[model samples]
Each structure stands twice: as C-alpha cells, then as structure tokens.
Target: MTALGLLYPGHSAEDDYPRIEQLLGSDIRVDVVHTDIGEDAHRVDALKEMGSPERLAAGVEQLRLTGAESVVWACTSGSFVYGWEGAHDQVRALARTAGMPASSTSFAFVHAAAELGVRRVAVGATYPDDVADLFASFLGAGGVEVVSVRGSGVITAAEVGEWTEEDVLTLARQADTPTAEALLLPDTALHTAALIPTLEKELSKPVLTANQVTVWEALRLTDRRVNAPALGALFTREPIVQV
Candidate 1:
C-alpha cells in the first residue's frame, strides 16, 4: 500500500482523508496528523504560524511513525497565505524534515488544475475576501488563471467544517463563471469529500476541493494514481507522466 501523510491544521475536515482512503480502496493509505493551530483565525499572521517549520516538523515526526512515503500540508489558507514563493519554501522544509516528497493543498490545486488541462478556474473560498485574494494570486503564480473569486467571509476553520452539503453547493454555484473551465473550493476546513461528484454534476464541470486535491497531491508525489470516480475528475484520470 502507498501511504500518504497529511499534516493537517486543527480539527476541521481532517476526517476527509480517511474517507478518501476508503474510497480509493486498500491500495492506498492516508494518515493524518494534526499540527498546532495556535489561533484558528484566517488572518495572515495566524495562518503563517499555523504552517510554520516548527509545527510541520513536529507533525512530520508523527507521520514518520506511520511509514508515510509522502507528506502534504493539508491546509490551503495556511499555505497560500505565505504567497507562492513562501509556500514552496514551506513544503521544501517539510520534505527535508519528513525525508519524503512533500507538498501543500495550495500547490495541490495548481497541479490538479494542470492535470485536468484546466487553465481557468473560479474560486469558492471560505476565507474573507482579502485572504481569498491571496489564493487567487498564488494560483496566478502557478500559471492558473482565476476568472473570479467569491469568499464566504468565514473567520475560522471550525465554522467552515460545520458547513452542510447544500452550503458547499451554494458556494460552488456562486463562484462558477461562464469563462471558468473549473471551480475550486479552497478550504481544507470545509467538508467536501462526499460532495465532489455532486458538485461537479450540479455545475456540469470540474469542482476541485481542498481535501480532494490534497490527496491527489500526495499521490502525485508518490507517482501513483487510483481509479476512484467518486473522488471526481482528478481521480478519474490515469497516472500523470512526470518528465
């Protein structure tokens, strides 16, 4: 089995990893280790602290015990709040600490978009508009165009985790645009593991969620792919050929 480690921040939506593991069958294993959350606010300072090297290192120690081949920081706002370059550095540090391939959900969205040949996307963010704007900018750095972004102005991960399936669908509908090739729900705190197929069907397009892309990113690092259509378009594709 290919084991993927997720260094999650706090209590929201970490359960999505296990749901993904079950969906992908026994060939893959997902292990989540919650890192220090410090303050659960979505502000830049709080997020930066959340993804700090010290906290990630601590989480890596736990993942090492799980025999995880790859590690991913499973928080979108926590990584993107560091901006594109800083996020790269963050994962680099994580890789060094884990002694494995490492990435973050922010980069996961970018890579997932490219995997599906989607250049333009609309964002359905649970962060405030200002924080969500940072995500758009980070995507821009990764060569994905943000056609539009709609933020829910939610302040904490706890609140986002409590959002129901209908709430997620509503956000997707609100963020989608005619010009966008796909829609992105960029909040790992939000529960979306069960809503991916529904969201894609309702929008009639690809809907990439934070947790979904996080698992995909871990698999990408391991050069593995699974046939799980229920996980939506990203998982339906074949393994990516890395040059």
Candidate 2:
C-alpha cells in the first residue's frame, strides 16, 4: 500500500478518510497526524493570521516520522494566508525538514483546478468575507480567476469543524457564478471532501474542496495516480503535469 502523510489540525479523521479512501480505492494508506489548533491560537491566526514557520515545520517533521512517503499541510487558510511567497517558503521549509515532497492545501486547490483546465472559479468558504479574499488572491496568482465569493465569517478552527453539511452545501450554492468554471470551498477547517460529489452534481461543474486538492497534490508527488470515482470531477479528469 502507498502511504501518504497528512498534517492537519485536530478533527475527526474517521469522518474525513472515507472520502479519500473512496478516491484512492483502498490501495493508498492515508496517515493523518493532527496538530492542536485550539491550544495554540496565539501562534496562528484564523485564515487571516500568518502561520508560524517554526510550528509548521515542527509539525511536518513529526508527521514525517509516521512512515509517510510524502507530507501535506492540510490547512488552506493557514498556508495561503501568508501570501504567495510566504506559502512557498513554508512548503519548501517543510519539504526540507521531512526530506520528502511537501505541499499546502491552498496550492493544491489551484493546481487541481488548473489540471481540470478551469480558468474561472467561484469561492465558497467558512471564513469572513475579507479573509476569503485572501484565498482568492492566492488562487488568482496561480492563473485562476475568482468570479464570486461568499463566506460565513466564522472564526476558530473548532467552530468551522462543527459546521453541518447543510451549511457548506448552502454556501456553495450561493457562491456559484455564471462565469465560474469551477467552485472552490477553500478551508480545511470546513470538511467538504465528502460533499464534493454532491456539490459537483448540483453545480454541474467541478467543485474543488480543500482536502480534495490537498490529498490529490500529496498523492501526485508519489507514483500513485489514483482514479477516484467518488471524488467528483476533480479526480475524474485526466492527470495533469505540474507546471
């Protein structure tokens, strides 16, 4: 079995892994090491705060020892909130520590969309409106256009995690734009992995969730090119070479 390591904040992996497993089809072993975001609120800000390089690096190091071939920082807000350069630096730093490939959920979203040949995308997030724009800008830098954006304005990882499936589905519907080729629910705190199939069916376009791309990118770094039927159009599309 191919092993992939995911470094995420505290949440229920039992709920998240099934969606990923459905995509990789039981051949991939996903090892998730959750860090405590609730305890160290001082070191990181919610979607808007700069992620601590020291803490992030340490977390990647810990996840690396979990027998993972590659590692991914599975927090979208925590990664891209640092801006493009900062996000790149963080990934490089984590890769250096792990002595393996590393990526962030934020970068994964854009790369996944690009892989699908999507140019315009709508934004759906559980963050405040202003904070959501930070994500938009990050994606825009990667050659994707942001059409419309909607946010729930919620703060704190715990609160975001506690949101129901209905909350995310509603937000995704509201954020859809006519010009959008895809919709991005870009927050690792908000679990949209299981909802990707539903979202794509409703929108009739690819709906790239945070964890979806995070996992996809991490898997791409390995030799495993998984075809996940349950992951929606993002995974259903052909494999794309990273530019």
Candidate 3:
C-alpha cells in the first residue's frame, strides 16, 4: 500500500486523517507522527512562534524514519507565519530530511487554488484575527487575491480538532465574501475533508481546506490518483500541475 506521512506537532486542531480514510476508504495509508507543540506554545504568542526550522526538521526526520513515500508539514500557520522564503526553506529541509517529496499545508492550499485558476478567495480560519490576517498576506504573496478573512480566535490546536462539521459550515458560510471565487478553510486541525462537498454545494464555489490540499499535493508528488467524492472538488478536479 502507498504511504503518506504527516509530521505534526503539539495538539493540533485540524488533523483530518480519519476523514481522509473515510473518503479514500483504505485505498491509501495515512500515518501521523506527533511532536509536542505544547512546549513551544509560547513561540506563537503573537503568531510569531511559527518559524522554528530546527524543531520542524526534527519532526520531519522522525516521520521519514517510518518509511513514507511522501511527507507533509501539516500546519498552516506554522509554515506561513514565517513568510515566503521561510516556508520554502522549511519544505526544502523536510524533503531533505525525509529523502522524499515534501510540502506544507500552506503550499498545498496555494497549489490547489492555482490548479483551479482561482485568484480571489475568502479565508475562513479558526485562528485569532491577527493570525488570520497574517494568512491573508501570505496568500496574497502566493498570487491569490484575498477577498476577505474571518477567524474564530480559538487557541490551542487540540480544541480546533474538536470542532464539528456543523461548526465549520457555519464559519465557512460567514467567511464567504462577494468577490471570492473560492472559500478557504485554512486550518489543518479542522475536519474539512468530510465536509468539503457539502460546503461546496451550499456555497456554490470551491471550498479549499488545509488538509484536503495537503493530501492532494502530497499524492500528486507520488503520481497517485484519487477519485473520492467525499474529498469534494479537490479530488474531483484535474490533477495538480507538476512543479
């Protein structure tokens, strides 16, 4: 079986492996190796604690040791808050560490949007307002037009994981803005893989969740094809362009 590994830290709110399994249904194996984000919690007091290359590299190496075909740094804020170069460097380090393809949730989201040829977006986040704005700027740098951004101001990744699909739908609906061609739920902790189709139908637009994009991009690196309806438009669309 093909294996895709995830290197996650702390108590993440948007871990979606279960939903991925439910959507893909045993076609692929998804494994996660966790690290303690609690100790580094203070690093992000002002959303500034996101760029820890040393810590991130360590996590990637650990996951790589498990023999994954591909690995991803499954955190949005953790990768983007460092700015463009920082995010790029982090991916490079991960790829080197794992001796395989690597990507982060932030990069995956941008790649997914590019694949859909979407420029304008509405960002639905579960971060504080400040962090949400940071993500907007990050997206802007990636050639995506940030139409609007809304956040739930929740802290602690574990809590973000506890949010239900109904909760996410409510947030997603509210985040939709007039000029947005796509709605982005940018939290890896939120279970977006399951609710993507419902959100797209309700909003009449593509809904991009962090985990959905990450998985799609990771699989793309390995030449894997996915045709799962539960993953929504991300899987239903054409394959992502190779970089």
**Local distance difference test values of all predictions, in order:** 0.92, 0.78, 0.79
- Range of the 10 consecutive residues with the lowest summed lDDT in candidate 2: 40-49
Q: Which candidate number would show the highest TM-score if scored against the true structure?
A: 1
Estimate TM-scores for all models.
0.97, 0.90, 0.89
lDDT tens per residue, model 3, 45-110: 433444366666667666766778998888888888878887898889878867898888889988
- Clash totals for all candidate models: 0, 0, 10
Candidate numbers, best TM-score first, in rank order = 1, 2, 3
lDDT of 1: 0.92
Q: Please identify model 1 stretches exceeding 4 Å from their true place.
A: 238-243
Per-residue lDDT for 154-214 in model 2, tens only? 7666677777889888898899988999999887777777788888888988888877888
Candidate 2 local distance difference test against the native: 0.78
In the range 143-216, model 1's lDDT, one tens digit per residue, is 99999999999999999999998899899998999999999999999999999999989998989999999999
Candidate 3, RMSD to the unseen true structure? 2.6
Candidate 3 Cα misplacement greater than 4 A, ranges = 13-15, 39-51, 239-243
Highest lDDT: which candidate?
1
